[model samples]
Target: MISEEEQKKEGKNEKLLADLCECCIMLHVGFQVSPKKVTSVGVHHLLKVVLKKEESEETQEEVERAFLALKNIAMWVKIDKELHLSEIKEIIKYHQKHRNLTHLAYQYAWEFLIHRFYSNESLEIIIVNELHFGKEAARKLEELRKNVDWTRKEDERGKETKEVLVITGWMKTIKSYFDSCKLWNEEYVELIGSVVQIYRTAKDNYEEIRYWCVFSLRNAAGNGFVPVDDLLKSGAVGCVLEDIRKPTLIDEITHHSLTFFENISRRLKEKTYNEMEEAKRKELKRKVLEKIEEEGYEEIIISLHERLNTLKRKYFYGDELSLNISDYSVNI
Candidate 1:
């Protein structure tokens, strides 16, 4: 298998260049590269070529054939599942660049599949693209968010409508929109503060409200409206506060997400500010090393080692240190 480093070395057009030919050998290799790694730009380029061909008797047949091949790649190989959320945003940017939304429906389909496979109650971090500036993306996301089903108890009186808590990528899209608006961040923070109050009040009485708090924490993490570290820590606190509710089977099941959130939350807190700062410094040094090579700089290999050793001594070992989690032991 070609390493990601090797693929990166070949430049970004790896799959697109490979897919242009009809030969089975090249096509087979392209398919083997995995849909997850198959850049969306590559897919869209192929789609454009097929769809825009000058009309001939065989044009429709050829386009259909190409579409089928790409479709098979998307479905059979689970490209969406392989793609990172950031990569999807990059794909969307590629489409926007070409003024093509022809495969947008496919993009949404992939996003949904990615969410379905990756999202669960326990996962704390959800990296989502902030689509505040794109009207089309906002509209599409609004349609998805509208499916939130909220209901109320018949016996409950003088209460506001309760909606099913939605855990989704769209909330981030909406929050990003608000953050981009003038005075919205101030309002957004106030709104979250109020919600935090509600969570505190309802902690004793309402299981549903507790659920909303958990959901909001995840949304806040995805939107980057709040530090992921803070939201996660709050989630751990929720496990302690909500433990008194004696949650039902369903609530118990849902609490798994809260627990996962708690785990990630604690992990982040364990990461000292000093450690992160030192790591960043080391990273900058590494980048400088790479830049030196890129510029074809001539330097003594021994001098390079000495310089690296000095930098490493200052930043490499401190109260601030890097982390590598090879395994996890969860005590439930």
Candidate 2:
């Protein structure tokens, strides 16, 4: 019963959809085969088409297809060995301009950037300029934190949980850049302070959030990036120590806390007496020991030592208990 003109219009629309799908498939194959050979022209053309869809009133199905295409292209570019920096910048630029995109689309764009350019110095500059260290990112984080209510059980499908997931994903991506090779610098102090504040305020039941905080702390503490004194001042060390001491702590949480402790202790141990004047070295060592004792590490170590001794005796003596405990206890 359709008119000829109406049928022609429908045919045109179907062809357009088919063409977009074909383009997406072709690009996916091209990138996988030879990413370096995939020129900007094809990418830009696809992006233009996608952006056009974004600006126009499109069907949800059409929009989703476009997003999928973009995500595939992004994944391809991310894995490319040649480092398509300009392509990454283009994606970020699109994200910055279209801040109203759906969470899934935005996450795709952000993931592309995080994977493609995290260790690149350009990322730091991009973060400072586009993300606005304190104003934009910090404000968003604080807003998300406030939205979460710790008194009630969290709904996995609720808005609060989704927001927390986004924040945690961002934290995990940022944590990777703070590894030993990178380290924390003075410029990042405010951002690091924000992370520490989040860690201190997060509820114990919110293990995902707490886990990333400790993960970031572990990286920040490594390679002597942040001085021991500064770390102590941030109260992160105390927070981690307290968490590890909890009777209900899980292995995953305990592992991260202990790793952070190990990083700090290993850094301190590297500063030999010959590296500094005797007075300064002794004072530094004394301060470290005092902090350890204050954090109850001394008791933990003593308990571990005693447990090891008991295990050694049981393993060696069977039930005899006659073997000299001194032989194993001396080294311990």
Candidate 3:
């Protein structure tokens, strides 16, 4: 009994419902999180865009159903900072109280906590400021800080949280040391020293200390020419050098350093060769007539031709030579 327009509308409605359901299912299973959780455009706008073609009743029903489903389920991984901060706190408390701190939910909360803390400096500050005895998170954080030197009166009283904060801050700036050829070596060194010091002081668990040590080592190694020999002499590489020597520790440091050295050497050699080529290119013009007169141009040309053929055989083929423009020149 429906008209053509109505049937088309119904199809559109079905498609929209299917899409919304798909999105909701993805959200439930913990996937496809929006990059920036707090957008200028509200959730309502997102809903509008997603449900644009659906019938009002179908859209409304789907939205309500999805919301209800979410209400009953606990969020595992959330990109939404505002929702994440408090909801995860409540979840942690529940897990701790139930003596289920080792449960799936606990691990999930702890993982999210690490991710959320590392996600942004400002978020980290907010979470740290909100931490206290009443919230079981304070104890968890205290555990995380176990390797940090809390023996100092200031650290014990939480007055000197700056050391812990510095280690935390290094995560973001550490990457800059890798990409920039002119990156300050001192900054990288200081960061490594500070992070290691904090880890050692914290008396953190073996894993925590190991984690920071690796981070420090990786950041330091990323700088192509770290004063690694000097550090070894100073005993700074003592803890991690053994780790690096181990094959299972990962080859990233060695690989990164080798690649960096290779790139630098390649560029330097290329530059030197280019300068030599330019000088040769210039000399070839002046020497063209003189060399041809002294030595028959045909012989010179023949020799060059042979050299070019050799280069082609080596580089162009399976051999190791490379041909250049100068390799085939003649006086004429």
Candidate 4:
């Protein structure tokens, strides 16, 4: 029942949408290679045009292309040091309005923003305004942790398993953001309590969840963002040492814990202990040394050294050379 002219117009629109999608794909690839150069005035203008198109005016293909373009632009802001505040705001608005309908689009858009503005304030805004990471998130995680029966297989939980998977994925994303930007500030310091609580709750729940907790803790504790005193007070160090001693713990967890310990130890060793008052210096050194000794670090290091010697003996034929003198036929 459609007229020939209307059919031709629809066909043209589809073709145009396809072309735009192709252009976006190319731009994304180019941005990956050299974002600073690709995000020039011309490209920025074209992206803005694409972004301005309303959902009603855009075909599904066009909408996807626009989102892709926005994501690339957002990523470019990270390396270029260019402030695309207006464009970023537009992407956020579009994502907020359309996230439920297209989750992946919103996800890439959200990540782009996170990477673009690598600061504690920006992260807090994303957490509170965009991701809503507060009491509700805490409540949901707590509820999921309560419902999870780790005695049974993860697959047996059905709906709860799905929820746990989603929550853990979100945790990993947040952890990655924290890892990428080492924001040492009061804002991040405040997050230590919530992070530690999540860590303790998720320790026995899922392997991936626990790994992320340790990874995030390592990054947070690195660069002195969360002070050693604070971490020790939170019992985070004890938890990490316990995890390291777990017979079934994954290598990733062990590696991150070791790195965390090394960072803390480096910080402690760098302290101006000699410059401090004698009593204070001795007290601080005593506390640190006592913690290290209580954690069985001396035994752990000795064991590692013995294991290394055993490996050397096994592989290097230590102090025992085996040569085929008969085949060599006397070198002289």
Candidate 5:
């Protein structure tokens, strides 16, 4: 099936992409040596690599490598960030439209690559809006939901490490979008139920996946645009409270859980309960709990106050609870 001319062309293109990756490595060193030595031309070459429409594994390999190289450059490059992000949006847009035209834009690897760009401050308004981050996030979460076998318990998942690769990667991808949420719309609100569902499903079986989902919730809860009403309707609070009650909870997960409660309470305080419609007020009270039960969730919250009185206190509580809950009793 192979012709000599085609074989030679393949070999040449493969070598070029390999050279591009090596050049990017050197660019990293060049930045380390003297930031001045890293010229705009290096970036121009890297950016142009993503535009390569060739469908070979070699091309995909170079695209992923180029993204890694761009992420490093983004950290220290003393250039206009908007210009960088603008070019990225264009490249992403191209792949977005063309990947469906029987091409490989690195498949799911693009999710990994896009998250690197999210660390930039421009994610708040520019790329997220243009790329439909929230909508895409919902779709990805739904795919994870359908593909994963939530009924299987952890120990029973023997020979299922392959399934885990799907879940862990997709969950990480979904969480990355929550890094810097500013603008909110119906698409963002649509995410509440799906996130809660995934957390509940993974709570018992997959610790790593559970942490990713909960941490994503924590990040979303931390922001000003958090839809308090949507969260209430979605049972997000109950899922988090369940996690907090876990006897095996680790310090980092505990810290994130506590922060979730803290941020939710702060956001709740900002709302005028007396002025809200009866439906919303009742929903908030019901979701957090009944009048006495409300105080109970608030009690857990009050415990958080004493528990997190200082950074040391918080760490000690989480550590002590995790380590000594059976050997000795502890209080928040």
Candidate 6:
């Protein structure tokens, strides 16, 4: 009862799968023996194949294969980011929108792209920001938040079920953008609200989500890149205040919160911000200093000097340099 078109489509899929399998085997064996040298042209063709198959309504298995092939190729060849603007936007557009297609995307973003060799000061950042990649990530994270129960219980989170790890991995990748490129793109700023919303709503036992959310926000707050209005609008400052106020907060979370406050005030600290070219920018920096005082955050920062001294004296009693808390500055 199969139609002729359906048969042809099945044949095409089978051939594509066979090709992907062969590609994986070849790469796997080649890598074990020695590193392979793939040219940029070869890498580009492979990327095209991966994109073509992934963008189609292929089966999940096919999508996984495509990304696996991407991983293998990336191990050998640094992707030539000299891609044309139109091509860069198209690639990021698909990758961001189809982030939920497979877990391989998570590893590729973290393990290969961001963690390893991706460059800064590239057109890639501009295109990704313009495409609203961060907004797409926020949307995917919101969707994952609903199925989080599947990941909470130890038994339910078995070998094959690692949805939450994928979510965190992608969040880490985005955080790298803040630390590395430090762009002031508005869409990236908007992502902060979604992370805070998830952190507030998830159950107390769901610490992975909260931990990553705080860490990511901490980087953005401290990086001195994003505009103050955009950051304030994203609700990040309020959410961080809540975290600081929590009675049972862990030291790591508290440490990051302090860093976040420090970084936000950096605008006023170093003559560090070139945005000072305008009078409004200077006022915004002053507002940051005022907000820190309103919440008694300056006091909290002062306490960290003592806390650091105690930690160093306990763990590193013999090292005089480690004991120096005199240089610590609240910079208000």
**Highest lDDT: which candidate?**
5
Count of clashes, each model: 4, 0, 12, 0, 0, 0
TM-score of each: 0.29, 0.61, 0.28, 0.55, 0.67, 0.66
Collision count of model 3: 12
Of the two candidates 1 and 2, the one with more favorable TM-score, higher being better, is 2
TM-score of 6: 0.66
Where is model 2 more than 4 Å wrong at Cα? 1-110, 118-137, 154-160, 180-183, 224-226, 272-290, 301-332
Model 4, runs deviating above 4 Å: 1-83, 87-110, 117-186, 273-301, 304-332
TM-score of decoy 5: 0.67
Q: Write the per-residue lDDT of candidate 4 for residues 1-332, one digit (tens) a residue.
A: 11222246444443444344436445565433344444443244445444544555344445455555655555444433345555655665665556432333444445555655553345555455544433333444455556666555666534446546645644655565655553344444445555666677667646777787787777655655456666665566666777766767465565566556656665555545455554554465566567767878656644444333333344331122122112111111
Q: lDDT of each structure?
A: 0.38, 0.53, 0.38, 0.52, 0.58, 0.56
By descending TM-score, how would the candidates be arranged? 5, 6, 2, 4, 1, 3
Question: How does model 2 fare in lDDT?
Answer: 0.53
lDDT of 4 at 124: 50
Which scores higher on lDDT, 3 or 6?
A: 6
What value does the lDDT take at residue 300 in candidate 5?
55
Instruction: Report lDDT (Cα) of residue 109, candidate 6.
Output: 32
Candidate 3 error regions (>4 Å)? 1-78, 96-98, 117-120, 129-237, 247-250, 253-332
Instruction: Give one digit per residue, the lDDT tens place, for model 5 in 153-224.
Output: 556866455445555655565556565556777777767677787788778777777887787787777676
Candidate 2 per-residue C-alpha lDDT over 55-134 given as tens digits, one digit per residue, 9 for 90 to 100: 43353334435544555555545444344446545655665566545444444455555554533555655645554433
Q: What TM-score does prediction 3 earn?
A: 0.28
Off by over 4 Å in 5: 1-31, 35-39, 75-79, 84-87, 98-123, 144-179, 271-287, 290-332
- Preferred candidate (lDDT higher): 2 or 6: 6
Please state the error at residue 127 of candidate 2 in Å: 4.6
lDDT tens per residue, model 3, 1-332: 11222246434454344345445444544644342321211232233332232335655455444333332222333345665356556544554555433222233334344444433435544433342211333234334456455555533544435335433433323332222223233433444554445445553323334454455454454444554332333233433433333334333332322222223223223222478775654453344334334434334334344444443443321222223433223222
